[model samples]
Target chain A: MFVTLWRMITFGFQNFFRNIWLSLITVLIVVLNLFLMSLVSGLNVVGQQTLTAVRQKVDLSVYFIPTTSEQRVDQIRQELLRKPEVQSIRLITRAEHLQELKKSAVDKGLVDAAIDALGDNPLGAGLVITSKTLDGYGAIANTLKDPKYQSIIEDTGNNFQTNQTVISRLSLIVNRVQVATLWLTLLFAVIAILMVFNTIRVAIYSQREEIGIMKLVGASDAFVRGPFVITSLLYGLVASILVTAVLVPILSLTNPFFAQFFAGYDINVLGYVREHLWTILGLEVAVGCGLSVISSLFAIGRYLRV
Target chain B: MVTFEHVTKTYQRRNVGLEDVSVNIEAGEFVSIVGQSGSGKTTFAKLIIAEEKADKGHITIGGWNITHIKHHEIPTLRRQIGVVFQDFKLLPKKTLFENVAFALEVAGERATRIKSVVPQVLKIVGLEQKMDRYPDQVSGGEQQRVVIARALVHRPKLLVADEPTGNLDSINAQEIIALLKKINEFGTTVVLVTHNREIVNMLHKRVITLDHGHVIADQQAGKYLL
Candidate 1:
């Protein structure tokens, strides 16, 4: 049994190198499949991060009357913090709001004019409220509308209807992108499978005479079939290694661009890829080897009758 | 040590490959089957190796009836009988040594046994010096010798040569015939199928002549009579 296995392994290498061009073409296809799978996963991570960042920026602010005391604003801040839906609430004093406006005006070269016109701080104190989810925003807005706080409140940004519309539209776009990526991934996967199948079939067809000779020499089915199957598995294995070698460097180079794209979102695409490198490569190897083996089995079944 | 008892075979389209053919050869006999094209010569060779099943009757090699041999058992039957074809079906990429050793490898022989037996068989066919050459690197006669060497690796009880010299020139054909004769002298049954009248006449051995899927004559010391 050991002798037979060694012979099969050696013959498999002989077959692989003997048809070098065809083997390379098969490996190339497997590489493309694995690369596309990784690309889809990367896009998914980036897309989720971008949507979360956009949603995080969509918070409501509760403005207080200028005469409201600092104590009252602090009480409102503490009450909002206790709510489960509220992620955070920051108290923006009138003076702090003026300072923020002045910094932005400086960027536009209108700082001096804006400060002269508003001698005293006309901006009201406010609370900036963030919720854990987009759906929670509506509940938080309703809670602020209670009569107890109406007297001191100058304006409550309770545009729930408009906010809901914007969130739904964003959700629609993100969902569509995910769906399209899935379909594209599936389509390419099918094409890659067919190409591998045909490549293996041609490889086996070229060895028809050799197969006949083996049968005449009294080779059993497993002995004759072993070399071709092993050759295909090698194609998958080598392709996976090639893809990882190429992908790691490419992903590293693109990390800065991805980080810039999701600047304030705290999304670390490179970190994600690094953490899941083995899992990603493992999935690719499984897929690559799986396709090659199945293709080889079918091709051998059709061509190697002996 | 081979027997065909009332065997019949018909191919698709109702073409007759063999018709109620029955023959027997004792141990260590050299027999030649001669016929015209489409006269069941190739079919008879195919049947002996179980490449084609007989439509009727039975074939037994050394008391083993193989009329209804299962698919998995075909390999075992072939290992016992060495078969050679006119085309010399050697793997083009494999060297002469690898080609010969392939027979033993397929039968799961140990590496030591393969290393020992393959060289011995190649030496018998006078190809020991050319063992490193690929099939395409050798002449037509040398390729056929490698095929024969491969056939002898198993030390089979019977060797069947189907038009083994069909692709060779006159001198090469004579050499192959001489080699087959030498192999037969070593107590192995040799069944040579051919249409070459000169070689057949020179053998002066038992000859079975077939015409249209039926045996016309079986003669001791036959003279290639049509």
Candidate 2:
């Protein structure tokens, strides 16, 4: 059996070299499939990171009136920190709030002049609230609504609800990104599969005489069909290496652009690929082998009825 | 030895391939099946090799009934019978040596055995010197000889030559016929299927003449009497 398998694999290579150009085209198509998948995956990771970064920025600020003492605000901050729902809360003094307002995305100089015109620190002290989980804001909202702290806590009508909406929207975008990657991968898979099927069909036609000779020589179906499977394997093997060779440099070049686009976030696509190189290669080879083998089998089936 | 009893084969389009064909050949016989195109000569050869199912008949090779041969069992039957096609059916990409070795390879023969056997067959076909040449790189006669070499690697009990010399020149055709005679002399049953009148008459062997999917004549020490 080993001998036969080895011979079949040799025959598969012989057949492969005959139509080197055609086989190269098949390898390219597989490479394109893998390339698209990797790019999409990398982009999806960056997209999720960006969305998470934005969601992390979504904090419900509880403003206490300027009359509330710094000690009292610290007490409220300590109490909120004790709750399981509250991840962390930073107490912002009136002066710190004014500084933050001056540094907002708007015209910083205009904001400073307006703050200076106020003649005193008019901004109220507040606690920037963060929840431990994405949906934990509801419980934090309930905690803030406690009767004891109600008078001190500013009546920010439904800030938790608004933050939840933003969070849910970001979650939706993340989900959409995931779904889009899946669809794009599937679409490329379908295209690659069709190319494999068509290429194998042509290969089968060219090798019909060889197949006939093989059959006449009393080759079992496995022996006759084994070469095509081997050919697909060769395609996958070669394409996998080529894709890696091409993709690594490509990811390296594109990493800078990605990092710049998602400025504050770390989008090292090349790093991710390097970390998972073997896994990516393994999955690619598996997918590539499966695609070509199944496609060749389908194309060669009806013709091998003899 | 091969036998066909009341074999009837019809195509899906209702074209008759063979009708009520019944014949038998004893061991070590050189039988030439002669007919014009579409006269079931190829069909007769196909049945012997189990390449085509006998729609309604009992077909056997050396007493093994293969009329209803299963799809998976075809390779086994074919291994025992070497078939030489008129087209030679040599893989164009493979060298003559590899072509011959491929036959043995299919049977899962070991490298040592294949190395030992392939050269001997190529020598028998007088192609040992040109064994490395691809089919397109060789003359038609040499290619046909390569096909014969490939067939002989199995040491098949029965050798079926379906128009084996049809693509050759007169001299090459005669050489192929001479080679088949030589193989038959070694106690192998030979079934030569052809329309070439000269080959059949030269053979002066057992002749089975087919016409319109029926055997109209079967003569001992016969000529091409179509």
The top-ranked prediction according to lDDT is 1
lDDT of 2 by residue, B93-123 (tens): 7888988888878877889988888888899
Q: State the DockQ, from 0 to 1, for candidate 1.
A: 0.71
Instruction: Please report how far candidate 1 places residue A302 from its true position, in Å.
Output: 2.3
User: Which residue pairs show collisions in model 1?
Assistant: none
Q: Which residue pairs show collisions in model 2?
A: none
Candidate 1 off by > 4 Å:
A36-45, A48-158, A252-272
- Residue A290 displacement (Å), model 2: 2.3
- Report the C-alpha displacement of residue A86, candidate 1, in angstroms: 6.8
Q: Would candidate 2 be rated incorrect, acceptable, medium or high by CAPRI criteria?
A: high
Stretches off by above 4 angstroms in model 2 are A66-125, A131-139, A158-182
